[model samples]
Target: MDAKVRNNTAHSRYELTVDDATAVAVYEIRDGAIAFTHTEVPRSLSGQGVGSALARGALDDARAAGKKVVPLCSFIAAYIERHPEYKDLT
Candidate 1:
């Protein structure tokens, strides 16, 4: 959990760096909505919770910014669905 997920607005994504690999959750902001597009984790880092961590961080960022989230990415939709506290974010 020490890994910090940071928002890279220049690339319109949230990223987390592990030992050697990077996990990214892509997003697009337009017309006041933040649309989560995709999430990717290096195969070598699979099953280590990197993706979940990345998702959580991205959602948290959106919440803090008081922005509406459009979970276009299934992973993000599922994450919010499973986490009821975040359901109101959509």
Candidate 2:
């Protein structure tokens, strides 16, 4: 599986593409903070780590840009819990 992640800023989402499936982690950027709003991983793409890829990519982007993270989405918050390096962003 050739999966890749991209930040589509115009759409406010970090998209993870695997084969024909695409998962998205939607977010909002405001006042130097990025609030992760939602995560959508299709059933066809479930259990393939697409959601984790999206979460990692989005959080990495936030860190690279020096932006704070408000993980409104439970998935992202949980991801942060698993990856403590990103905790300070919250």
Candidate 3:
């Protein structure tokens, strides 16, 4: 099934949803950057690219907001490295 990435503005968070019940990953934005401060996916959801989707969503949001991304989390940092299109925004 396709995954969905959505922003929860009320909490400054991003959620990656697969199907209808699973929250594959969650992240936060702060200080003009997207911070993958918290991330989790059920064991069943692991290895399904959900984390990457979450990072991408967060980075996209940052770009749309005209802000740089710090990528404090290793996963997010690695994602940025792999997706050079986001480099200029960093």
User: Which candidate number would show the highest lDDT if scored against the true structure?
Assistant: 1
Better of 1 and 3 by TM-score: 1
1-79: candidate 2 lDDT, tens digit per residue = 4566899989999998887778999999878799999999999999978888789888888889899999999999999
Model 1 lDDT per residue over 11-70, tens place: 999999999899999999877978999989999899999989999999899999999999
Best by TM-score: 1
TM-score of every candidate relative to the true structure: 0.96, 0.93, 0.76
Candidates' C-alpha lDDT: 0.92, 0.89, 0.69
Worst 10 residues of 3 by lDDT: 20-29
TM-score of 3: 0.76
